[model samples]
Target: MKLKLRIWRQSSADAKGRMVSYELDDVSEDASFLEMLDVLNERLIAEGDDPVAFDHDCREGICGACSLVIDGQPHGPQAATTTCQLHMRKFKDGDSIDIEPWRAGAFPVIKDLVVDRSAFDRIIQAGGYISAPTGTAPDAHAVPIPKQDADAAFSAAACIGCGACVAACPNGSGMLFMGAKVAHLGLTPQGQPERATRVLGMVAAHDEAGFGGCTNTGECAAACPKEIGLDVIGRLNADFRKAAIRAA
Candidate 1:
Protein backbone atom coordinates (compact mmCIF):
# COMPACT_ATOMS: atom_id res chain seq x y z
CA MET A 1 0.00 0.00 0.00
CA LYS A 2 1.03 3.60 -0.59
CA LEU A 3 0.03 6.43 1.74
CA LYS A 4 0.34 10.19 1.89
CA LEU A 5 0.82 11.37 5.46
CA ARG A 6 0.18 14.92 6.62
CA ILE A 7 1.81 14.93 10.01
CA TRP A 8 1.95 17.62 12.68
CA ARG A 9 5.61 18.44 13.26
CA GLN A 10 6.66 20.38 16.33
CA SER A 11 10.15 20.53 17.73
CA SER A 12 9.30 21.53 21.31
CA ALA A 13 6.29 22.33 23.45
CA ASP A 14 6.50 26.03 22.63
CA ALA A 15 7.59 25.59 19.04
CA LYS A 16 5.31 26.20 16.12
CA GLY A 17 3.75 23.16 14.46
CA ARG A 18 2.32 22.59 11.03
CA MET A 19 1.17 19.72 8.91
CA VAL A 20 4.02 18.43 6.77
CA SER A 21 3.29 16.02 3.96
CA TYR A 22 5.28 12.90 3.08
CA GLU A 23 4.67 9.91 0.87
CA LEU A 24 5.26 6.24 1.62
CA ASP A 25 5.33 3.36 -0.79
CA ASP A 26 5.48 -0.42 -0.36
CA VAL A 27 3.73 -0.26 3.02
CA SER A 28 2.52 -3.69 4.07
CA GLU A 29 -1.17 -3.99 4.80
CA ASP A 30 -0.27 -6.09 7.83
CA ALA A 31 1.86 -3.34 9.37
CA SER A 32 0.45 -1.69 12.46
CA PHE A 33 0.25 2.11 12.35
CA LEU A 34 3.33 2.57 14.53
CA GLU A 35 5.23 0.06 12.40
CA MET A 36 4.39 2.11 9.35
CA LEU A 37 5.75 5.18 11.13
CA ASP A 38 8.91 3.24 11.86
CA VAL A 39 9.31 2.67 8.15
CA LEU A 40 8.88 6.36 7.49
CA ASN A 41 11.40 7.31 10.17
CA GLU A 42 13.88 4.81 8.67
CA ARG A 43 13.51 6.43 5.30
CA LEU A 44 13.95 9.92 6.74
CA ILE A 45 17.10 8.89 8.61
CA ALA A 46 18.57 7.41 5.46
CA GLU A 47 17.85 10.70 3.70
CA GLY A 48 19.54 12.76 6.48
CA ASP A 49 16.19 14.30 7.48
CA ASP A 50 14.95 14.48 11.02
CA PRO A 51 12.63 11.58 11.81
CA VAL A 52 9.12 12.06 13.03
CA ALA A 53 8.55 11.58 16.79
CA PHE A 54 5.60 9.58 18.13
CA ASP A 55 4.71 7.77 21.36
CA HIS A 56 4.51 3.98 21.42
CA ASP A 57 5.11 1.06 23.74
CA CYS A 58 3.70 -2.44 23.97
CA ARG A 59 2.44 -2.19 20.39
CA GLU A 60 -0.04 -4.98 21.11
CA GLY A 61 -2.37 -2.22 22.43
CA ILE A 62 -2.14 -2.97 26.15
CA CYS A 63 -0.04 0.10 27.03
CA GLY A 64 -2.16 2.76 25.37
CA ALA A 65 1.08 4.58 24.60
CA CYS A 66 0.74 4.80 20.85
CA SER A 67 -1.54 7.78 20.32
CA LEU A 68 -2.29 9.32 16.94
CA VAL A 69 -5.17 11.01 15.23
CA ILE A 70 -5.56 9.51 11.79
CA ASP A 71 -7.75 11.39 9.35
CA GLY A 72 -9.59 13.23 12.14
CA GLN A 73 -10.22 10.05 14.15
CA PRO A 74 -8.50 9.73 17.55
CA HIS A 75 -7.13 6.28 16.70
CA GLY A 76 -8.06 6.11 13.05
CA PRO A 77 -11.56 5.31 11.82
CA GLN A 78 -11.87 2.05 13.71
CA ALA A 79 -14.18 1.84 16.72
CA ALA A 80 -12.93 0.61 20.14
CA THR A 81 -9.27 0.41 18.98
CA THR A 82 -6.10 2.27 19.88
CA THR A 83 -3.57 3.61 17.44
CA CYS A 84 -1.12 0.80 18.15
CA GLN A 85 -3.78 -1.75 17.30
CA LEU A 86 -4.73 -0.04 14.05
CA HIS A 87 -3.51 -1.86 10.94
CA MET A 88 -2.40 -0.49 7.60
CA ARG A 89 -4.98 -2.58 5.79
CA LYS A 90 -7.69 -0.42 7.28
CA PHE A 91 -6.69 2.19 4.76
CA LYS A 92 -6.90 2.11 0.98
CA ASP A 93 -3.85 1.54 -1.24
CA GLY A 94 -3.54 5.27 -1.95
CA ASP A 95 -4.99 6.91 1.06
CA SER A 96 -4.26 10.34 2.48
CA ILE A 97 -3.75 10.07 6.22
CA ASP A 98 -3.56 12.91 8.69
CA ILE A 99 -1.32 11.97 11.57
CA GLU A 100 -1.42 14.16 14.66
CA PRO A 101 -1.29 14.13 18.45
CA TRP A 102 -4.07 14.37 21.02
CA ARG A 103 -5.35 17.95 20.86
CA ALA A 104 -6.30 19.22 24.30
CA GLY A 105 -5.06 21.92 26.63
CA ALA A 106 -4.35 19.38 29.34
CA PHE A 107 -2.33 17.34 26.83
CA PRO A 108 -0.04 19.79 25.10
CA VAL A 109 1.98 18.51 22.18
CA ILE A 110 5.63 17.93 23.00
CA LYS A 111 6.77 17.22 19.48
CA ASP A 112 5.52 15.73 16.23
CA LEU A 113 2.98 13.23 17.57
CA VAL A 114 4.02 13.09 21.25
CA VAL A 115 2.14 14.96 23.96
CA ASP A 116 3.01 15.51 27.62
CA ARG A 117 0.48 13.28 29.35
CA SER A 118 2.02 13.60 32.80
CA ALA A 119 -1.05 15.55 33.76
CA PHE A 120 -2.89 12.26 33.75
CA ASP A 121 -0.35 10.85 36.16
CA ARG A 122 -0.97 13.79 38.45
CA ILE A 123 -4.70 13.17 38.35
CA ILE A 124 -4.22 9.52 39.29
CA GLN A 125 -1.99 10.40 42.21
CA ALA A 126 -4.70 12.66 43.55
CA GLY A 127 -7.09 9.83 44.41
CA GLY A 128 -6.90 6.73 42.22
CA TYR A 129 -5.36 4.42 44.79
CA ILE A 130 -6.74 2.21 47.54
CA SER A 131 -5.43 2.56 51.09
CA ALA A 132 -4.70 -1.11 51.61
CA PRO A 133 -1.70 -2.04 53.70
CA THR A 134 1.11 -3.74 51.82
CA GLY A 135 0.68 -7.39 52.67
CA THR A 136 -0.37 -10.69 51.23
CA ALA A 137 -3.58 -10.69 49.23
CA PRO A 138 -6.70 -11.35 51.27
CA ASP A 139 -8.27 -14.72 50.78
CA ALA A 140 -10.52 -14.75 47.72
CA HIS A 141 -13.52 -15.40 49.92
CA ALA A 142 -12.65 -12.83 52.60
CA VAL A 143 -14.95 -10.17 51.14
CA PRO A 144 -16.98 -11.58 48.36
CA ILE A 145 -18.11 -8.92 45.88
CA PRO A 146 -21.39 -9.42 44.05
CA LYS A 147 -20.86 -10.52 40.48
CA GLN A 148 -22.88 -7.61 39.06
CA ASP A 149 -20.92 -4.93 40.93
CA ALA A 150 -17.68 -6.73 40.23
CA ASP A 151 -18.44 -6.81 36.54
CA ALA A 152 -19.30 -3.12 36.47
CA ALA A 153 -16.16 -2.23 38.38
CA PHE A 154 -14.09 -4.41 36.07
CA SER A 155 -15.56 -2.68 33.05
CA ALA A 156 -14.69 0.73 34.44
CA ALA A 157 -11.23 -0.51 35.37
CA ALA A 158 -10.64 -1.38 31.72
CA CYS A 159 -9.72 2.26 31.15
CA ILE A 160 -6.08 2.45 30.02
CA GLY A 161 -5.53 6.15 30.95
CA CYS A 162 -5.32 7.01 27.27
CA GLY A 163 -6.19 10.67 26.60
CA ALA A 164 -8.38 9.81 23.61
CA CYS A 165 -11.43 10.55 25.72
CA VAL A 166 -10.26 14.09 26.32
CA ALA A 167 -9.02 14.52 22.76
CA ALA A 168 -12.39 13.57 21.34
CA CYS A 169 -14.30 15.82 23.73
CA PRO A 170 -15.42 19.17 22.38
CA ASN A 171 -14.69 20.65 25.82
CA GLY A 172 -11.55 18.59 26.35
CA SER A 173 -13.07 17.25 29.58
CA GLY A 174 -11.36 14.45 31.49
CA MET A 175 -14.74 13.43 32.90
CA LEU A 176 -14.72 9.99 31.31
CA PHE A 177 -11.23 9.24 32.51
CA MET A 178 -11.86 10.69 35.95
CA GLY A 179 -15.20 8.93 36.18
CA ALA A 180 -13.66 5.59 35.29
CA LYS A 181 -11.06 6.07 37.98
CA VAL A 182 -13.78 6.90 40.47
CA ALA A 183 -16.20 4.11 39.55
CA HIS A 184 -13.75 1.21 39.43
CA LEU A 185 -12.97 1.68 43.12
CA GLY A 186 -16.17 3.35 44.29
CA LEU A 187 -18.18 0.29 43.31
CA THR A 188 -16.35 -1.94 45.76
CA PRO A 189 -16.42 -2.24 49.55
CA GLN A 190 -12.68 -1.71 49.74
CA GLY A 191 -13.15 1.71 48.15
CA GLN A 192 -15.53 2.90 50.89
CA PRO A 193 -12.97 4.37 53.24
CA GLU A 194 -11.93 7.12 50.84
CA ARG A 195 -15.08 7.30 48.73
CA ALA A 196 -16.00 10.88 49.52
CA THR A 197 -12.45 12.16 49.46
CA ARG A 198 -11.65 10.30 46.25
CA VAL A 199 -14.31 12.08 44.23
CA LEU A 200 -13.40 15.48 45.60
CA GLY A 201 -9.67 15.10 45.16
CA MET A 202 -9.86 13.52 41.70
CA VAL A 203 -12.31 16.12 40.45
CA ALA A 204 -10.18 18.90 41.87
CA ALA A 205 -7.08 17.47 40.26
CA HIS A 206 -8.88 16.99 36.98
CA ASP A 207 -9.85 20.66 36.84
CA GLU A 208 -6.39 21.74 37.94
CA ALA A 209 -4.98 19.76 35.05
CA GLY A 210 -6.76 22.19 32.69
CA PHE A 211 -9.34 19.66 31.56
CA GLY A 212 -12.67 21.26 30.68
CA GLY A 213 -16.03 20.18 32.02
CA CYS A 214 -18.22 17.63 30.31
CA THR A 215 -21.44 18.65 28.60
CA ASN A 216 -22.76 15.10 28.19
CA THR A 217 -22.04 15.07 24.46
CA GLY A 218 -20.87 11.41 24.79
CA GLU A 219 -17.90 11.93 22.49
CA CYS A 220 -15.51 10.71 25.17
CA ALA A 221 -17.19 7.30 25.51
CA ALA A 222 -17.44 6.97 21.74
CA ALA A 223 -13.72 7.60 21.32
CA CYS A 224 -12.71 5.45 24.26
CA PRO A 225 -10.62 2.47 23.16
CA LYS A 226 -11.86 0.51 26.15
CA GLU A 227 -15.50 1.45 25.51
CA ILE A 228 -15.85 2.98 28.99
CA GLY A 229 -19.41 4.19 29.15
CA LEU A 230 -20.78 7.66 29.92
CA ASP A 231 -22.66 5.93 32.70
CA VAL A 232 -19.41 6.12 34.63
CA ILE A 233 -19.64 9.88 34.43
CA GLY A 234 -23.13 9.72 35.86
CA ARG A 235 -21.80 7.70 38.76
CA LEU A 236 -19.06 10.24 39.24
CA ASN A 237 -21.56 13.10 39.36
CA ALA A 238 -23.77 11.33 41.84
CA ASP A 239 -20.84 10.54 44.06
CA PHE A 240 -19.61 14.10 43.85
CA ARG A 241 -23.02 15.49 44.80
CA LYS A 242 -23.34 13.17 47.75
CA ALA A 243 -19.81 13.87 48.84
CA ALA A 244 -20.30 17.63 48.65
CA ILE A 245 -23.54 17.48 50.62
CA ARG A 246 -22.02 15.34 53.31
CA ALA A 247 -19.05 17.69 53.58
CA ALA A 248 -21.47 20.55 54.06
Candidate 2:
Protein backbone atom coordinates (compact mmCIF):
# COMPACT_ATOMS: atom_id res chain seq x y z
CA MET A 1 0.00 0.00 0.00
CA LYS A 2 1.04 3.62 -0.56
CA LEU A 3 -0.15 6.61 1.49
CA LYS A 4 0.30 10.34 2.01
CA LEU A 5 0.90 11.54 5.54
CA ARG A 6 0.37 15.07 6.84
CA ILE A 7 2.17 15.07 10.19
CA TRP A 8 2.65 17.79 12.78
CA ARG A 9 6.31 18.70 13.23
CA GLN A 10 7.54 20.80 16.13
CA SER A 11 11.09 21.09 17.41
CA SER A 12 10.21 21.99 20.98
CA ALA A 13 7.39 23.05 23.26
CA ASP A 14 8.35 26.70 22.76
CA ALA A 15 8.59 26.32 19.00
CA LYS A 16 5.66 26.60 16.60
CA GLY A 17 4.60 23.59 14.55
CA ARG A 18 2.99 22.92 11.17
CA MET A 19 1.81 19.97 9.15
CA VAL A 20 4.53 18.53 6.95
CA SER A 21 3.70 16.18 4.09
CA TYR A 22 5.50 12.95 3.23
CA GLU A 23 4.69 9.91 1.14
CA LEU A 24 5.38 6.22 1.64
CA ASP A 25 5.14 3.60 -1.11
CA ASP A 26 4.83 -0.20 -0.91
CA VAL A 27 3.91 -0.07 2.76
CA SER A 28 2.69 -3.40 4.20
CA GLU A 29 -0.96 -3.44 5.22
CA ASP A 30 -0.10 -5.79 8.12
CA ALA A 31 2.38 -3.31 9.62
CA SER A 32 1.34 -1.35 12.71
CA PHE A 33 0.91 2.40 12.35
CA LEU A 34 4.05 3.07 14.35
CA GLU A 35 5.96 0.72 12.05
CA MET A 36 4.97 2.92 9.13
CA LEU A 37 6.35 5.96 10.98
CA ASP A 38 9.53 4.00 11.67
CA VAL A 39 9.85 3.34 7.95
CA LEU A 40 9.43 7.05 7.26
CA ASN A 41 12.08 7.97 9.84
CA GLU A 42 14.49 5.39 8.45
CA ARG A 43 14.04 6.84 4.99
CA LEU A 44 14.64 10.37 6.35
CA ILE A 45 17.81 9.32 8.17
CA ALA A 46 19.12 7.62 5.04
CA GLU A 47 18.71 10.96 3.27
CA GLY A 48 20.54 12.78 6.13
CA ASP A 49 17.37 14.76 6.92
CA ASP A 50 16.03 15.17 10.44
CA PRO A 51 13.80 12.27 11.51
CA VAL A 52 10.26 12.64 12.80
CA ALA A 53 10.08 12.27 16.58
CA PHE A 54 7.29 10.27 18.20
CA ASP A 55 6.79 8.40 21.48
CA HIS A 56 6.64 4.62 21.72
CA ASP A 57 8.10 2.54 24.54
CA CYS A 58 6.16 -0.65 23.87
CA ARG A 59 4.92 -1.31 20.33
CA GLU A 60 2.07 -3.18 21.98
CA GLY A 61 -0.96 -1.24 23.29
CA ILE A 62 0.01 -1.56 27.00
CA CYS A 63 2.23 1.55 27.17
CA GLY A 64 -0.17 4.07 25.67
CA ALA A 65 2.89 6.17 24.78
CA CYS A 66 2.02 6.19 21.11
CA SER A 67 -0.24 9.23 21.29
CA LEU A 68 -1.25 10.37 17.82
CA VAL A 69 -4.46 11.83 16.51
CA ILE A 70 -5.27 10.27 13.14
CA ASP A 71 -7.75 12.02 10.85
CA GLY A 72 -9.01 14.19 13.71
CA GLN A 73 -9.66 11.16 15.94
CA PRO A 74 -7.65 10.23 18.95
CA HIS A 75 -6.16 6.75 18.31
CA GLY A 76 -7.83 6.60 14.89
CA PRO A 77 -11.32 5.47 13.82
CA GLN A 78 -11.46 2.09 15.52
CA ALA A 79 -13.28 2.08 18.85
CA ALA A 80 -11.29 0.88 21.93
CA THR A 81 -8.02 0.78 19.96
CA THR A 82 -4.72 2.53 20.68
CA THR A 83 -2.62 4.16 18.00
CA CYS A 84 0.14 1.56 18.39
CA GLN A 85 -2.33 -1.23 17.76
CA LEU A 86 -3.75 0.51 14.67
CA HIS A 87 -2.67 -1.28 11.49
CA MET A 88 -1.98 0.09 8.03
CA ARG A 89 -4.90 -1.92 6.61
CA LYS A 90 -7.31 0.37 8.46
CA PHE A 91 -6.50 2.82 5.67
CA LYS A 92 -6.36 2.05 1.98
CA ASP A 93 -3.87 2.56 -0.79
CA GLY A 94 -3.47 6.20 -1.86
CA ASP A 95 -5.02 7.43 1.36
CA SER A 96 -4.15 10.77 2.88
CA ILE A 97 -3.77 10.57 6.66
CA ASP A 98 -3.52 13.47 9.07
CA ILE A 99 -1.37 12.77 12.13
CA GLU A 100 -0.90 15.12 15.06
CA PRO A 101 0.05 15.06 18.72
CA TRP A 102 -2.53 15.28 21.50
CA ARG A 103 -3.84 18.88 21.58
CA ALA A 104 -4.58 19.98 25.13
CA GLY A 105 -3.39 22.71 27.47
CA ALA A 106 -2.29 20.15 30.05
CA PHE A 107 -0.51 18.08 27.41
CA PRO A 108 1.72 20.64 25.71
CA VAL A 109 3.78 19.25 22.84
CA ILE A 110 7.45 18.66 23.55
CA LYS A 111 8.78 17.65 20.13
CA ASP A 112 6.76 16.39 17.20
CA LEU A 113 4.22 13.91 18.64
CA VAL A 114 5.64 13.80 22.19
CA VAL A 115 3.76 15.73 24.88
CA ASP A 116 4.72 16.38 28.49
CA ARG A 117 2.30 14.08 30.34
CA SER A 118 4.00 14.51 33.71
CA ALA A 119 0.98 16.51 34.80
CA PHE A 120 -0.81 13.17 34.98
CA ASP A 121 1.94 11.80 37.18
CA ARG A 122 1.57 14.75 39.53
CA ILE A 123 -2.17 14.23 39.63
CA ILE A 124 -1.60 10.57 40.48
CA GLN A 125 0.77 11.60 43.21
CA ALA A 126 -1.96 13.77 44.72
CA GLY A 127 -4.02 10.73 45.77
CA GLY A 128 -4.14 7.82 43.33
CA TYR A 129 -2.08 5.45 45.52
CA ILE A 130 -3.08 3.70 48.70
CA SER A 131 -0.58 4.47 51.43
CA ALA A 132 -1.82 1.64 53.63
CA PRO A 133 0.05 -1.57 53.32
CA THR A 134 -1.69 -4.93 53.25
CA GLY A 135 1.25 -6.18 55.37
CA THR A 136 1.83 -9.58 53.75
CA ALA A 137 0.11 -11.16 50.75
CA PRO A 138 -3.18 -11.97 52.38
CA ASP A 139 -5.05 -15.20 51.73
CA ALA A 140 -7.23 -15.10 48.59
CA HIS A 141 -10.40 -15.42 50.63
CA ALA A 142 -9.43 -12.89 53.29
CA VAL A 143 -11.28 -9.86 51.92
CA PRO A 144 -14.22 -11.57 50.21
CA ILE A 145 -15.13 -8.62 48.01
CA PRO A 146 -18.61 -8.61 46.47
CA LYS A 147 -18.47 -9.84 42.86
CA GLN A 148 -20.22 -6.82 41.36
CA ASP A 149 -17.96 -4.33 43.15
CA ALA A 150 -14.91 -6.36 42.20
CA ASP A 151 -15.93 -6.33 38.56
CA ALA A 152 -16.48 -2.58 38.58
CA ALA A 153 -13.14 -2.03 40.25
CA PHE A 154 -11.37 -4.17 37.66
CA SER A 155 -13.03 -2.24 34.81
CA ALA A 156 -11.99 1.06 36.34
CA ALA A 157 -8.47 -0.25 36.87
CA ALA A 158 -8.24 -0.92 33.12
CA CYS A 159 -7.55 2.75 32.61
CA ILE A 160 -4.07 3.15 31.11
CA GLY A 161 -3.97 6.92 31.66
CA CYS A 162 -3.55 7.42 27.88
CA GLY A 163 -5.07 10.93 28.09
CA ALA A 164 -7.29 10.16 25.09
CA CYS A 165 -10.27 11.04 27.26
CA VAL A 166 -8.78 14.46 27.89
CA ALA A 167 -7.64 14.96 24.30
CA ALA A 168 -11.05 14.02 22.87
CA CYS A 169 -13.09 16.18 25.23
CA PRO A 170 -14.12 19.52 23.72
CA ASN A 171 -13.54 21.18 27.09
CA GLY A 172 -10.15 19.47 27.51
CA SER A 173 -11.35 17.88 30.74
CA GLY A 174 -9.45 15.18 32.66
CA MET A 175 -12.47 14.17 34.69
CA LEU A 176 -12.81 10.75 33.09
CA PHE A 177 -9.20 9.94 33.88
CA MET A 178 -9.66 11.25 37.38
CA GLY A 179 -12.86 9.31 37.74
CA ALA A 180 -11.17 6.07 36.76
CA LYS A 181 -8.31 6.68 39.15
CA VAL A 182 -10.64 7.52 42.02
CA ALA A 183 -13.23 4.82 41.40
CA HIS A 184 -10.82 1.91 40.97
CA LEU A 185 -9.65 2.26 44.52
CA GLY A 186 -12.87 3.67 45.93
CA LEU A 187 -14.61 0.41 45.07
CA THR A 188 -11.95 -1.82 46.55
CA PRO A 189 -11.77 -2.98 50.15
CA GLN A 190 -8.20 -1.79 50.63
CA GLY A 191 -9.20 1.67 49.39
CA GLN A 192 -11.98 2.23 51.93
CA PRO A 193 -9.93 4.17 54.46
CA GLU A 194 -8.94 6.97 52.10
CA ARG A 195 -12.05 7.02 49.88
CA ALA A 196 -13.11 10.59 50.59
CA THR A 197 -9.62 12.00 50.68
CA ARG A 198 -8.56 10.25 47.49
CA VAL A 199 -11.33 11.77 45.41
CA LEU A 200 -10.85 15.21 46.98
CA GLY A 201 -7.09 15.24 46.48
CA MET A 202 -7.03 13.90 42.91
CA VAL A 203 -9.84 16.21 41.76
CA ALA A 204 -8.01 19.18 43.28
CA ALA A 205 -4.78 18.21 41.55
CA HIS A 206 -6.64 17.73 38.24
CA ASP A 207 -7.88 21.34 38.41
CA GLU A 208 -4.50 22.70 39.49
CA ALA A 209 -2.94 21.04 36.46
CA GLY A 210 -5.03 23.30 34.14
CA PHE A 211 -7.51 20.60 33.00
CA GLY A 212 -10.86 22.04 31.97
CA GLY A 213 -14.04 21.14 33.82
CA CYS A 214 -16.25 18.32 32.49
CA THR A 215 -19.78 19.19 31.38
CA ASN A 216 -20.97 15.55 31.06
CA THR A 217 -20.93 15.68 27.25
CA GLY A 218 -19.78 11.98 27.20
CA GLU A 219 -17.12 12.35 24.51
CA CYS A 220 -14.49 11.04 26.90
CA ALA A 221 -15.87 7.51 27.03
CA ALA A 222 -16.31 7.33 23.25
CA ALA A 223 -12.63 8.06 22.69
CA CYS A 224 -11.29 5.93 25.53
CA PRO A 225 -9.15 3.08 24.20
CA LYS A 226 -9.73 1.21 27.45
CA GLU A 227 -13.49 1.74 27.14
CA ILE A 228 -13.72 3.30 30.59
CA GLY A 229 -17.34 4.28 31.09
CA LEU A 230 -19.17 7.42 32.26
CA ASP A 231 -20.42 5.77 35.46
CA VAL A 232 -17.03 6.28 37.05
CA ILE A 233 -17.53 10.02 36.58
CA GLY A 234 -20.83 9.75 38.45
CA ARG A 235 -19.07 7.89 41.24
CA LEU A 236 -16.43 10.61 41.40
CA ASN A 237 -19.07 13.33 41.58
CA ALA A 238 -20.98 11.54 44.28
CA ASP A 239 -17.84 10.94 46.29
CA PHE A 240 -16.79 14.57 45.96
CA ARG A 241 -20.22 15.81 47.02
CA LYS A 242 -20.23 13.64 50.12
CA ALA A 243 -16.68 14.63 50.96
CA ALA A 244 -17.53 18.34 50.59
CA ILE A 245 -20.66 18.02 52.68
CA ARG A 246 -18.71 16.24 55.43
CA ALA A 247 -16.16 19.04 55.41
CA ALA A 248 -18.97 21.54 55.82
| Candidate with the greatest lDDT versus the true structure | 1
lDDT of 1 by residue, 1-248 (tens): 98999999999998999999999999999999889999999999999999999998888767878788888889989999999998998999999999899999999998899999998898889999889998899998899899999999999999998889999999999999999999999999999999999999999999999999999999999999999999999999999999999999
Report the lDDT tens digits of candidate 2 across residue range 33-132.
Answer: 9999999999999999889998888877888787899999999998999999999989999999999999999999999999999889988999998876
Clashing pairs in 2: none
TM-score of each: 0.98, 0.98
lDDT of 1: 0.93
Each candidate structure's count of clashing pairs:
0, 0
lDDT of each: 0.93, 0.92
Q: Pick the candidate with the highest TM-score.
A: 1
RMSD of each: 0.7, 0.9
